[model samples]
Target: MEVPKKEDVINEMREILGNNDYIVQVVNTDNEVVNLLDQESGELQLEATANIFIGGSILDRGITIKNILCFFYGRNPKNFQQDTVLQHARMYGARKKEDMAVTRFHTSSAIYHILSRMNELDNQLREWFLQGNDQSDLNAVFVGYDKNIKPCAMQKIKVSDALTLKKQQRVLPVGMWTGSKTATKKMMAEIDHLVNESMCGQKLDADGFFYMNKDVAQQIIALIEDTYVYDEKYGNIDHKSDMRELLCALEYCTERSGGKLRAMVRTDRNMTRIRANGGFIDSPEDGRTDLKPARERALHEPVLMLLRQNGQKEETEYGNIGWNNAPFYWPVLLTQEDLAPVMFALDQRRKGKQLTIDLTEMLEGVNPDEVLKLSYAGNPIDQFGKEGTTYANAEEAAVETRWLKESVASLFIEKDEQGNWKHNPAVPFDEKNDHGVYSLNHGHFPFVLRDYKYILLRNGRNANAPLMLLELFPKDEWIIDPRGDFDEENNLLDDNGQDILLYGSDVIYDKNMNKTNFEDKSITLWYIEYPVKRVVKYKCLKK
Candidate 1:
């Protein structure tokens, strides 16, 4: 009843393989996924397949191929996402270990940099993660190591990737993170020293960041570049950023801004795992190499904590074991105004010049109208009844509407990083989290890594409270039945993660229904979260 069309894909596949024997098929929903086997060859078929299979978005993750000898990934890798790349790394386990030698990675130089960066981060995460597993070490359990950028929870437990980890170099921090008041003051003075020397001729235009000249840029890099000098206890973490990356950034600045580049020496530590959903609990204080910052301020800016040694009671540095000397002693780069005046006059009562400045009060200015609230939008959920145009029940509409108007109050955070807050991240990663890990009772937003324009919060005295996003429409806006990251076995979970709805296998569709995901039979809480700006006026046909 169907005739084959002359498809460009088939021709392209034939040309690529240099053979006329390859097969290519375009699969539609009408053709069930279960029967995607060839009639003659009996090989597994997909949306499209040959000796080489090809697909996009749908093929980005989930499917596990055995003996996938070669990978030809030539996609653009600008702002690279590491989890996506890991998913595409089809070769794994002892089964495909031999396949590594012959397996080729044909990618651009940028992708190479991305991979190098990721691999470097992975090694550090593995080392610290293994150390953190010790429950008795309260310092390790509740310290600053929380901020290290990690791979998905599943990947964190594995160290068998011979290709990425074999003979791996340690990735050291860029500079010292200081916790001492004297150190903070001395550092601020040093910046003042640099400023007096460098800003003599450099004009402060409204266009660039602090220390806006190229020479100053060079100076900052030079100061921090070699600070990773010899350390006995922790050995060394190879330098993270270098002249090459800075030079590239400089070049970009010069070419784009004509003659100026507003540069900033970013003292940041907000690296994240994009695809890993360790569930809606708030992530613990991201550990840093310096002492932890005040709690309230931690929410806005990434804070580096001074950590204890991985295995010992002392801090993770090199000093005479009990003399209280920091193993590492680097200075924090900060604005002179934010730092207390350098303590030139020291007295017995003065502790290292006493730079007792509250960074939180300085950083988090109280914005009177700042809306920490999440917004919700869509077809009136559950309220639409048999009338189709009116409310299913007055009580349902009234309850939902009253709930919508109510606002969520600000949260209470504590010293041990616990509070009346809902984003509790005590949930372990690297495993199944369907019922246990994800709880509606917790008032936290689901953990996801996508760049959402906004967030929403579902309201009401419901069993499960969900976070929401605003202005999301049906077409591409609502990410219904979205996919989750791989589990420990590398198997994809259908019911968990962002926008994923699990229908218990059977899905009978009604063609007349709007394209949002209610057609699927998922038992999970309706944490409705899709969004855009509140100012952008839009409409949904489902309404």
Candidate 2:
């Protein structure tokens, strides 16, 4: 394959951006040709303005470009490291609201999908950190299993862990024959009773789809192994193991989606066999599509589709292909894409398969016996306890730690008039529910308005909390006063001297905390704005 020259790419970019206010600079390791830095102090000597740098790996990692309104990443390696791919995300970090609106990111669909999944995984890891999970405690890092992509180099991750199916992935049985006619008939009858009798109200939809709870879905999955038989004579996927993994993925999704999933029994399909005596190949609907599935309009839910094929072999136009005369249900599980990557913790030591650490490779030239032991800075018993600091009890230590973590609400971030991001002192707010207290600020902060129901509880203390905090739901009479402004003492008030409060409703309250009859209230919040639309285009690259 012929690689395009850097000069050609630069010239093309120059032609496209021609004579604009933007400045274009080519930055690479070839400093001899185009020098932009001082030799003595290593400081950038270029003019201070909006500049676009055309370079390869040089723009990655530690490189920082302020106000990066546009980013075009096309680097595609044969293999990808999770860290290396993430570090190339130079567009991350603080930016002014105006610049952020025009910010654009261009990449291939494959790369875009990979980055989106990685972003979800990264967010999960961040939540764990925010809940005070130590690095050592985070033993399992869930990564989508791709032959080209790895979590990192094997040497980087010292431990060996078993891989599991990633979230939002589709799993279906491939290359399999059906069970005996006697067995399948019994299985079908059982399925009929289970769906119609056991699950009555949740009947089959108008489109042949049946919405079932998590337990019912599990029951349907259990019937697959008995009805669809994966012959041992042929090299086929392990039915038991695959079913278990599919169930795991289902459990993860259903738990988040209110224990609901739509199942469809797709029957009378003429799916031909792969080879003589081999199981029938999958249909197009068996695979996942970017479009949302039926019954469950929520994009963040799972779908279970069962294929009931005509179990009879005949001389077809293609060849003598089809399953045996035993109609069976082949399960295809489509997982939810919006959830965090599913990871399972497996203790290899418990199974007598411990991965021994090679000290020679790890320490290199250092003597293993003479290696000094480094202790944790904090007390081993208490996570929040620091060295030389004493607490009366564990409760006291926890309280102090919670206070320190919540201290960030004391200030809010906003952009100054010069289009620079800055922090301002925030007015304090404290609200308590069954699951401890939630502190918010009275100053403007960046926010993305989303449906309240789908929001996952990330706080550790609220791990077992309900999806919706009932008390926080807005009341009918509660309305925010649009004309309300903070007084000299930081107390929000309207023009008529009614105190503005957002605790229960958006309406103004009296000194005794009773809502007034002012129906002309409007919604007001110290909230941030986001762009209404985002455009992502795909690039089809040829070898």
Candidate 3:
């Protein structure tokens, strides 16, 4: 078998190659050239490859000039599977000098054309190819090829291979931090900024971002747990007591809308001594002795009365009234009507008599006219007339008069143009005058308003005894002038006849002989204002 010429083999190989095969071989040779060119030009270049096949007896006898020419003319050059002779002939021909030069030139030129197109493409899509630019355009171009063209897959595979090769040669530089502490702090600050920024835009879901950073989440959880434990251990006794008192007060206020009683007993007296002295008494000394002594102090009880109805068929078919519990030292009975049923039941049980009295009839015959007439007469009144001039003996009248005088005194508050209140003078007055009036020469005409119910008036410095001692009358006792005002209605008489209401006003008279002035007077007066009832709910602690 004669070997084929190089020119013949080159022609045969070209004839045997399909379009894809030829392009692939061309790409392979072009890739080598591109590497060489990249090194020379200090820039990247594209690469590609090509493949070819021959058939029948020509390929089996190996290649020859005649066979090569035949293959190029579209003949079945060889079927390498059926005849090794033709395959060998073609192989021998492909190695010839002329064929090598021609093959190399053809592949090289193809590569050059492909590389040129690539460079053109690179320039055309410079923005996409450049670093720091959006890679979306390049991705979009590749996606378009994948979707619209059939041979685009092969092109993409080739491009990917080229990219992999280029990336292998490229060396990435390493970075080092010059100042460790500063760089670490900067990085931490950046992380904190990012965390805060992420949290700022939305409702913070602890489970989401908080828990995403495990270390931070654990720290927060620990802090919260510690706080909860601390709170649980040291319970707030004052707050709890305050809450209870508030609730009780609210309940009392709800039950009694019109009026209520608040009582405070002075515990300074020796209660044990009094009890011991009274216990040694042989018998009731007098009718007064059976009654509790007035000196033996006891707190007043607050009571709420409510009316209830009974069925018509019952023998005592009437609305029975009762009193609700309140914060008090002793039990309280509200009205005369509330006392009748108990009295009647006790009488029946003691006497063992089954006498059924018609309560309604009995009540009707009780002569209410006399009782109503005597009601006003039995009330206590302030005897302020000539030595023994009897005033109206009515408790209600007295309380009304006192409340009126107090309310009239509370209206004036001397405020400057800026609405700021001026300070009141703090002067000690001689509390011994019989009229309960004191003279003070503290540069200002200072007058003190004392509780009329419990004032201890003194004439001069007597250290031992008050000149005119007054005691706190029960709320039901004491006269309150309904029309007394500190200004035009009931002005204080100064020597010059000018009204001397002065700067301090809005006075409160508690049962404890304490006077509270609301116009920013002495610190004592200021402190009293703090305990005043400002809201519907409150507590009264006896400290």
Candidate 4:
């Protein structure tokens, strides 16, 4: 048989690819092998003495050729031939094909081992990576792969970068409930004690512990009822009358002394007991234990006597039991300036003016529009109702209409003068009240706005303005009239958008006092829309 020409071999290879529908096209027809229209299946198949290149025609197509075995079909030339011909002969062909197969096998095996080792190493390194690069040497030493397939120094550098990238993408810790050891121990002890007390007389083995502790049950019940009475009287106060008297006297003394007498007294007999029983003793060697009784006499006794006199007088005249006699006792008090802003805000509220502070603006520095979006639940109608909708342009009207349909109704209506229909005077109507003025069951806009402002201030924003409003609404006047206003069908009336008007109040002044510069001010105003009803407001008259 005549030797095939180089052109013939090329044409034959092209024909084979074309016949099998695997050929895309061919390129670089000079001396070097270059692929242009290459298609790959599971395996590669080539009938050539020359080197060939192969890949997918479309970059994304899967390789589908199978069994990819190659065999040289030409014989070696006996004499030196042209370099190109020698390179393409059977001897070079077989050697090149062998090398390709060996290289592929080794590369595959190496990759598999690397991946397996990588998983193991990753598991070991996971914690280290999470802790960050604070311990770099430990991370470097612990990272390992098979010695034969060990990554190069460059690969190590890349791996370190990869680790850092992974760490950066990790989630951070949210809120922390951290505390000192003493605090934690105290909390745990309290919880355990509560649980024990709760389960104290319960049955253990069948009618066992409960039946056995009958007297104990009676004692526990009595204790609970008695303690409940004390709790009611003092709230969180430790020594009912004693603490109250001491506190009151201390206040008087402090004011008289221009706050020079800043000392606090413990009037609770329990506190005296603790001090005597070494409960208040921080160390046995402190040497001040003998002075406990003296301190109590000098601090607590006088205060208690003064408070008793005041309480007796109050009881005689007004039949009012002082708050000091309440069950629980919490010794926290607010001074006039401490409550100033709230008083001012309350005054503003009484005069029928919008008193509000945007918390989002103060804390987050977010855009007003974004803040509005966060506060608003849905489209204009959805949040505000059809008539309540505020539109910036006509295009928004259709969208707003669609949004209103999906939204909850917030419209409230009230009869105005001349028997004409009018929107509820309150802005941000509550669904449960006919009148926009806040009652227990409805009128929540002021509360929500106030809370939002508080949160902003709590989060380190300027909350001074909102605090003023808080003073306007004293604790005593916090009454919610659940049954105040309802529709004819007895359904709760929605506040509509008029609930916003609830915040419109001028200045509320103290009923008895005419001093314009009082430390704390209490004022009442008529609801702007419902002028017949008086709303009490508190303010700090300082600033």
Candidate 5:
């Protein structure tokens, strides 16, 4: 493909502008660049005249355009670098109130959406810093992740613990209980009635599907919150805390998307308590990956999927995971893709030790679109040096199953044969290892694990290990680093699209409790699309 000549570019701009009243200058590397700096004084030089100047990376930084009343940005690169993209905000800075009021930004809808999310993230960071928020008080700094948008240029970043929430992500709660059978039955019936009365007209193509406004969605969330019970000890769930974060993210999205949300009332799922591959709940009836039809219909809004389980009382393979023998509704919140492909820099430090997210350095670049195609499940236990594997026999499986029912202490600490307290051999626990069990659930059981190795290295672990740092995904799947590949410098080797990412097995248990063909063979970084933008403290689960 031949590049268009400068004359052709000037002609096209002239035609688009509709008139040749202003001089069109192609201020590029080949052309005589417009004078932006005084030759001798080195001060800004330019006449207060009306002229149209077009440039590329040259205009990305260290160059200012005066009185940018109307900006027409149309650089359609396949991948966008966040730092370079933000630097193109030459239109920003102090301006006359009247001039600012009249200024307008023009870009494609795709570019506009990502830019809007980036602006929100930038503003959030600025607000926290300006308000004199202590570094210790900070949680995570969120950066909207998009397939087309790269957070920062590759090669520039070496190592980072940046947590990501990808676009079009779904988050569900699996490790939870729905009260007693009677209470669950009553709650389910009441919710069914509420949906029939309020969301009947908003039905989608599916039988139990409906689209709702923020008001109706809030009602449903509240009902689910009231009916659900979570035991932070064995089960890594806290309905109340999760609900709060959900409501917060919902409000943020509602303000932008006109308060639209989708819901599905799936009944009689009969899903097992412990699903394969870290799923809190099983797939939709069609088994087409978390009800793809309903998700596509919403386009750019949250989907509140309510699945009613069969409430089987019989013991599951992993034994009873504390769910009461009663039919209950399981709610899964699917945050929209409009504000995704993001990262959060959370200060998970407790009791003030001085740790901050340097937004400039923490940014990373990866083609998340490629990552989203693979269906990978994260095992939180993997971070503790335990590779996901299958049970050799039912007896071995039962031993691990019993651990799931044990206290939170059992996860990391255990009593030896002599009944002496010792660090669990499974976990490589050390004073230098800065890991915390974050109590925020995003699909995977045991909630999100905080691994701020960089932060904790300086001060070391506290008396009580304070949970910090987390990553959320947009889709139902998780991010995987299967090869266990790292650079010589010990940096995570960026994905080059060669590795095969396995999809959909939370923990590779021996199928049928017998060592079978399927045994987890690799380690992966688990991420779920989480919409909670700010860092909020959740009580440590005590068994």
Candidate 6:
């Protein structure tokens, strides 16, 4: 920030350009709008003299740099939301890979992790895109882990869709299928023989589990790749490559590293697919949210049955079900930066403010800290998002974020058959009219939130940040006019915390929240932890 250091930076940039004549300049809000432009031509004026420019977070997004060869970004936020971090990737469209040295991204290790995760997310979304899926289409997609570190809320997959979720539970693969068909035939003929030799007559699991030494597992994976077919419409070669790579790496981590790879094979097809509110595939995330391709499926078949949990009824058969009673995990997970917002909320709640979480609906046999599934089976160490509801520390999210500030402003409202402003009865309202008023009684679904983000992200209307924005809402008396109707002036009725935010929207979205209890009536916000982070982290890296 010092002038002399800035001069040195400019001078170094000039040396890089081999042009002493290049102009160096400092631009900021102090400069008028016209100062950023060439008044004569009305074009964006380039600070050509000084090729190096220094500023803060304000310039992080929106501007395009066509010839930027080097980007040095040092400012890192206390919390790193993926979307915000990706915005600083100003070097996106740079095409000269050979000249990548000229076009480089310089940031800290923490920032690099965020950028890497963003890229992983983009790639996963790309795979879904190739399936002819778009943001507007409702699909049982895995976007990312919610703060509970679970697969974010998904459009509950229809049982009729025949899309069953197959999760490997509480175990690692002993040996990936990599042997030649002849070898596979040989191996299958005497799986016991192969394991007996490796384990001295001991099976990893009584349920037909067997062990294969690292060398044998490696051979099997190589063979699987050599033999796996990629001809099916839903089977992508990339997915196959990913599976083989995963098995190979797992072998390296467990078997090759002199540890046994524990695995189990189940014949039970009665397993229920437990979709967390904002849940995804279970632990050891491996980054692949899509179902295993046919090529890989041939080796590890899905055995979980698709069903709404017992004691829970569908509004319509196979229709979307409320997530409150679905499942839950404990001790909510949050980004490190989210601590402040969570603490802020706790402090406010201490004043007897209604920061309540809905706990009305109970999935039988479910409780906090213990992961619950429909079967009431003990929580698997490897699974996540099987829990009921999870909360996010939205306080860490910046209040100035466009999506956070404008979410209610942009809700898409659909009309019922009667043509009334068919409001979602779930949101609170005044007795006089369906006057929208902010209240703690409201509970939200993760899918709807992600849907908005998905649409906005596609059209460049969103920042692709975490959906943890609601916590930024002021805990005490920050009334937001949900009806979104304001005077022509778009007036602010008050300057205090009770200010009425007058807003109107082109589309009215169906907004609803989790119901705490029918008898309790009032809503209070509460956060409980969930162990779902691994399921997200595992599937990110590519071979």
How close is every model to the real structure, measured as TM-score? 0.26, 0.35, 0.12, 0.17, 0.41, 0.29
lDDT of 1 by residue, 46-92 (tens): 33333565555544555455456556555542134456666665533
RMSD of 1: 22.6
- Residue runs of model 6 more than 4 Å from their true location after superposition: 1-23, 30-34, 40-44, 47-49, 94-101, 132-138, 144-543
All models: lDDT? 0.32, 0.48, 0.24, 0.26, 0.48, 0.31
Worst 10 residues of 1 by lDDT: 162-171
Clashes of 2: 4
- Model 4, position 422, has a per-residue lDDT of 37
Whole-model alpha-carbon lDDT for candidate 5: 0.48
Is candidate 1 or 3 superior in lDDT?
A: 1
lDDT (Cα, tens digit) per residue for candidate 3, span 127-190: 4346432332112221101101122223333432111111001111111001223323443344
Which numbered prediction scores highest in TM-score against the true structure? 5
**Tens-digit per-residue lDDT, 367-451, candidate 5:** 3221111111223232211222333332223111111111242332335566544433444443332222211122223322221
Q: Tell me the tens digit of each residue's lDDT in model 2 across 143-253.
A: 434434566765554444444554555666666667768767878888767656534766554566666667877887778666765533333433335565566567657
- TM-score order, best first, reads 5, 2, 6, 1, 4, 3
Candidate 6 per-residue lDDT, tens place, 356-381, comes to 32222321233322322111111221
True-vs-predicted CA distance for residue 101, candidate 4, Å: 7.9
Q: How accurate is candidate 2 locally (lDDT)?
A: 0.48
What are the per-model numbers of colliding residue pairs?
25, 4, 43, 66, 23, 50
Q: Candidate 3: where are CA atoms >4 Å away?
A: 1-380, 383-522, 526-543
Q: Could you give me the TM-score of model 4 versus the true structure? A: 0.17
Is 1 or 2 the stronger prediction by TM-score?
A: 2
Write the residue-wise lDDT of candidate 4 on 1-543 in tens digits. Answer: 344577986897788666663533232242212232134432333444333433222211222222333422222211111222323222222334445443222123223344445455545445545767324321232233322222233332432321111100111111111133343344434433433564466543321111112222223222222322222111212222322222332332333334431111122321110122112111211114312322332331111110001111113221222322222211211122111110000001112233354443343443333211112111222222332223343222222110111012121123356543334345454443332223332323222221111111111112232211111122222232222233332323234321111221222234342323211111111121101011111111112
Q: Positional deviation of 410 in candidate 6, in angstroms?
A: 20
Q: Write the number of the candidate with greater TM-score, choosing between 2 and 3.
A: 2
